[model samples]
Target: MAYERLYILVEGDDDKRFFEKILTPLFEGKYDQVKVWKYAQQKKEKVSQFLKSIKGMNADYIYVSDIDQEPCVTARKQYIQSKFKEIDKDRIIVVIREIESWYLAVLDDKSSKRLGIRYSNTTDNVTKEQFNDLIPRK
Candidate 1:
């Protein structure tokens, strides 16, 4: 399906930056524009407000959040679904552990070593604390 625009609501600035770097190139000619909004980890309230504000807007919405401390991915997905029942469940993505896990997965082995992180093919086992240590502070 063709979409006029794509709206991505993420947890924070880091997630926004990550998506812009990764998605912008892939979606450059697909949509008129792809906008990423940072909800600052304030999931439910911010999402509710965004949905209400864009009631009639012509755009595809994608909500991304980290499954932190949740029992499992299913439970996390259920929580997000309960918050915004109107949105399509397919658009909701609950990242395992955290977005940092995604970063680690995408980074090449050389890059991982440069960042002092042992390259792991699977990120599901990586903890947030371990990922935090590898990130260079600005």
Candidate 2:
């Protein structure tokens, strides 16, 4: 199916970049454009206004957020739904743990070795703190 346009609302730059680098290409011919919007970057007021601006535009949007501190995806989705009433409950994509793990999950062995970290196919267990620790400190 072809989409006139697809908007992906993500929590941070990493998620936006990920969608751009990976998802956008896959939708090359399927969508006229795949725009990744980092909702976190916008001021709360601006975001709300922006959502209102886009209302009734016949646009397709998918919201993505991290499962940070939330007990479950449902709760997170509920919270976001409350804030962004325009967002459909079923359209939110809550990243398991965080987006970092998803990136790590796809890293090749050479990339993992270059980063001086042992990688496993399942990166769901990798936390931001653990990944941060891998960075060389001056």
- The model with the greatest TM-score is 2
TM-score of 2: 0.83
> Could you give candidate 1's per-residue lDDT for residues 24-102 as a string of tens digits?
6787687888888887656677678786665567577788888888898778888878878766678888888778677
**lDDT (Cα atoms) of all candidates against the true structure:** 0.78, 0.79
- Tens digits of per-residue lDDT, candidate 2, 1-138, equal 534777788878777788999888987677687788888878877777766655555667778888888899899999988987767788788988988788788788999899877868788867777766777898
Candidate 2 structure lDDT: 0.79
* Candidate 1 residue pairs that clash: none
The root-mean-square deviation over C-alpha atoms between each candidate and the true structure, in angstroms, is 2.9, 2.7
Give me the overall lDDT of model 1: 0.78
Candidate 1 lDDT score at position 69: 80
- The count of residue-pair clashes in candidate 2 stands at 0
The stretch of ten residues in a row with the least summed lDDT in candidate 1 is: 51-60
Total backbone clashes of model 1? 0
